[model samples]
Target: MGLLDLKAPSQAGTMTEATGQSSALDPGTPQWSVFGQLTSPVTHPWAIVGETILLPLIAVSLGLWLNPDDPLWVHASFPWAWFAPVVLALRYGPLTGIGGAAMLLLVWLALNLVHPAEFPKLFFLGGLILVMVIGEFSSLWLARARRAEAIQRYLDQRLEFLTHQYYLLRLSHDRLEQDLISRPMAMRDALGAMRNHIATEQMDSDSAGASALLRLLAQYCQLEVAALHYLVDERLQTTAIATLGNTSPLQADDPLIEHAMQTGHLCHIAQSLNQSEQSSRYLIAAPLNNLDGECFGLLLVEQMPFFSLQDETLQTINLLLGYYADSLSMHALAAQIRRKEPDCPPEFAFELQRLWHIRQSSQVSSVVVALEIQSRPGMPDVAQQIQRQKRALDENWLIQDVDRSILATLMPLSGQSAAEGYLSRLEMWAHQKSGQTLAELGIFGHILPLDTDPPLALLQRLNEIAHASAQTRPLRPHA
Candidate 1:
């Protein structure tokens, strides 16, 4: 509220040397004073009041003890009792020092006026005023220094916090790159490279994604040959197979493949777990499951390193293959729907039909939120997070440009305010919750009503927003 209260900070410093701001300044405490525990600045109100009142009382008590017959300063042996007030003024601020000195001056005046003047009143009063002035200067400087230190501590803590967030964000992006793409890179530049890959590789056709996934395995997993199997009519059948590095492509399903398909869990040819005399070549098969937990396909690998057969590696392969299968399933389903309808996509046709009815109703409204990601890669995790947080009535679309970075969500029966609120939440998740700052991301078209805005026009506006979001944006990261 005031300069005096500047001693306190809104929050404590982070876990660093410049930790955080102090709520209050206490001169007696460490780091509170300019010198090591030198000046104890007056903080507590009652402590200063006591010191001011107690000094004057002690002076009066000493005078009365010296002369019981007349308990007045004039009857005492000493004329000047100024040491107590001076010391109090030096330790406390101007208020306490001046108040105590004024009491002593009253005693001095009574003694000199009643009896005789032994000491010059002008000289005595001048000395008291000087001490008060000196004490005030000392206290003022001490307060300023403490306030500065507290502010500095707060800034340092903020810097530390931001540094940690950036480091972790960078690390996650790097790990994502290493896992998603088989290219090794410097830790610092991993995210940028991954972003580039995502911008190019994202929203690829099911065939393209599967092909890339197999290529990745060939490079990183050190597989000589890989095959894909699909579950058709309750039986596993080979769909596609890839070979690399002079390895022969296996057309027939081996016992290893059949066994892996029989059991849903990943199966691998290993010397430690099984001692059967088989070919020295290594083989592994992992099942790709859908949301319903039904096996959709099989991912086969041959001649992989035994060391890479651990649970972590198997899990990673399974997840990647599963994601690839999901893309395949979605694209295949979309094609089927389009062929049957021939007029419009099944979902789009249904939405338009529903919009026709909702248009007549005066109560219902619908809007769209178009988010354009400018910095981070549009990974599956980000989409999954949006899906988890989205409402049942909303339609989430993965619309890709040359630089696949934007996601558009349409509200079928929702107002403008609801759409904007959801946009704010998405911004918060990107910046605060997901550790990806909105500074690099941008929002366009606060809300667009679906009933009023044409579908093609809305898409064009969203595309315009995506282009504009990256051009003019903030780079600041918030906690």
Candidate 2:
């Protein structure tokens, strides 16, 4: 998560380098120099032991060389030999500083054997107290430093992710500007047309709309030579069902195709295959995958103008292919759901299925709120007010009857909390508009999660509840 692991920004000389905290500093790696190792908290235990044993010994030897009569430096203006233990405590911690002081004690014992001098208890005791105090300060700062480093690492990763997203956004904006000048229709329009085409045409098999998908890719991607192949028995077929231009035979073992299949994402020439492998003959290969990670087909672009083979262009192709795959899957799912519940609106069923797939793939949640309003003199007007206040992304299916009105609103990418918030808002708004709360008006709500139950079952339950509401009588005037 450090700056060292991040990809370099497009522009050079970032603030990380300006402050001299270069990205080359890897905290995990061992430092080479003894001082360097001591400065870092990641030093090895053996290294610490060696330094602890040697530092005091070196100081004693220097003291002996300077004044053999008082090698402990007790009589000197300053106790020079005690400085070693103090430094060790500042670098490591209290325990290490205590270890260094113990080594000095051992040295004093060994010297006493030779000279029979009195043990300097005051010298050793004072040194121990100072080392302990300094070690405590060191420990406090070390903890704060580690916490700061962790925070900095997290910030670095978030900044890197945002930088990459910004770069992609800029590229997409450029692509949009170019498309506005060159293309006659918007990308959303093209996707809508493709969706409509798939919905209207018969999709008896997996390869039902392969030709239309190829034509759409050709028109948008300017693919000079490309082919789309269907998947059979969990494998991509060797034969191309639809080709844009004069295309060669499909290579089932192509590296790009194999990578796309393995990763279930688009793989292009720019991506690094293994270092041992050579360049692939195709420019790009992408799997036509739905939101649930199901691959129905593969797209291979053999040739395109050099100028058009950009990150933005490849992203556009990937998006279009994914959209097509999802459309096919949605059409099939919607048909199955509609077959089970005839009264469910086509738009409501299709969106519910799509949201279910999204939940399975991305873990995003969606909620369905079913409101049953008993038929009364003023209830129809309340339903109209609620319908007008629907969120932009919400899809509603209103079923009106002589005895009751059922309004089912599908809130996409929302959970139970969002559903509760929405109901609360509706309650307040309805009270303000109708001068009475929803409960007083005989309006009840049931929250159904798209993920908790299958789409068909959720729709069926909503309908069953509506039917039950029809048999009930309206609320009388409140006492």
Candidate 3:
């Protein structure tokens, strides 16, 4: 009735070719193929409503032209006018199918006034039942399809993240291969040192670790002279926050710097430029950016060894700067939580902040589970025992006193249900290993899901609850 082929009656007649590809049609089949496009259900509201209205009207009009006396064909061998509603029911489901049926009822009533025919109750009743049956089945299958699409999208994101990480790994390996013999320090060692410096230092301003960061870059990048400048209100500040190896003041209008600013990526002398760089002093310009594409600072290379200026060296600079920017951002966000809980591990705080960002942007969730363990007479520390069971992606922070310990585990990309399942598993493990339940072993569990509250705030609240419980309980004298 809708002009599409009836050969695939099971398939819906809704979307065009583009929608088919987005909805994940078979990879082997071309999107333009009739089977691919027409089979997919229409998700847009206007399209569904339009088709639901138009198809039944077409059927009714055709019926009127063929037989004015019994346009619905109720008295004929077959009630052909009911075809549109049944097809629609199979396509979109019950609500749309029921709408088509209601239209036919209105038409039937109008015909009764003109020709004075009987009610024909059985005809309409049978069509409604058929439509309802087909629509119910369609609804169930459509829900499954939508759920599958969501899962596919999440997997795609994970794959993309892994691919980027793989490229970073390859780049690091290439750098190591090129510099291992000449350079005394490895990239990983330098990175670890930088992370330790960031963890220990107080980030009072945007240029918190500027000097140390520049020194690290100088060591790795073989820079004879360079300067790092922080951005203020989207404009580069003239004064250099950190300078290495006798660098002059930054030139704000340098061609390389302007190019880097315009493109939001690393720019060097070798790159094509519209402006003449004959007067420019800097050899390379790089923006310190995080994964979110926020540029907080700029690195200008005033001088470097001629032979050292290569693709590998430039990529190393870009990668290190990006990593530093991301780390700095995390430290800034985690600083508040760190102040609230001084004993909290910096790694845990940093990860919590990162996960909070991911949750906000992608709606994927992560949870923090706190397990309080009281030292028992015979058994080993339950907190440390649980720490050994940390999952691959989980980060654990264990705080220990003489007689008590609190183990806070951050399960990345997990939800409330996942936390519950983890707790249940831990409870079973405790029973099996210690021959007693969690209660018997003096271990208490609390699940704090990262939700409406900020992650830093949530972690601070967890510390408060833990401290309150510690203060109220009576302490046993140390032996």
- The lDDT of model 2 is 0.72
Per-residue lDDT of 413 in model 3? 75
Please provide TM-scores, in order, for all candidate models, with all chains considered together. 0.36, 0.50, 0.60
Candidate 1: lDDT of 202? 31
The TM-score-based order of candidates, best leading, equals: 3, 2, 1
lDDT score at residue 225, model 1, on the 0-100 scale? 68
Candidate 3 at residue 450, lDDT? 85
Task: Please write out the lDDT profile of model 3 over residues 1-479, one tens digit for every residue.
Answer: 21112111012222111111122364333457687577667789999888888888899899999987678889899989989898888889999999999989988888787767778889999999989999999888876676555445545533433444455577668768987888767767777777666666875444547777787778777888988888889999898877888878677877778778876767677552324535567878888876546889899998888777765566667667866776777677778777777677777887787777666665667898888787877767567778888886688988776666778899987888888888788878987997777877788777788877897678766766466556685432111
* Tens-digit lDDT string for candidate 1 (1-479): 22222111112122111221122353223454466343454568897787777877686677668764443344334443566677777777666777887777676566567676566565556656776787788688756665555444434433543444454455447566766554554333532333223223433323444455666556545666666655677776544533344444444446555555555545666521353444433367667663224676677676666566554454445445544443444344344333443433334433433443454443245677665543345553454566577775465665545553556676665667787678667777776765754545533334557766645565556556555544474322222
**Comparing candidate 1 with candidate 2, which one achieves the higher lDDT?**
2
lDDT of each: 0.53, 0.72, 0.73
lDDT of 1 at 337: 32
Q: Candidate 2, after superposition: displacement of residue 305 in Å?
A: 2.0
Candidate 3 local accuracy as lDDT?
A: 0.73
Q: List the residue pairs that clash in candidate 2.
A: none
Please count the clashing residue pairs in each candidate, in the order shown: 5, 0, 0
Judged by lDDT, which candidate is best? 3
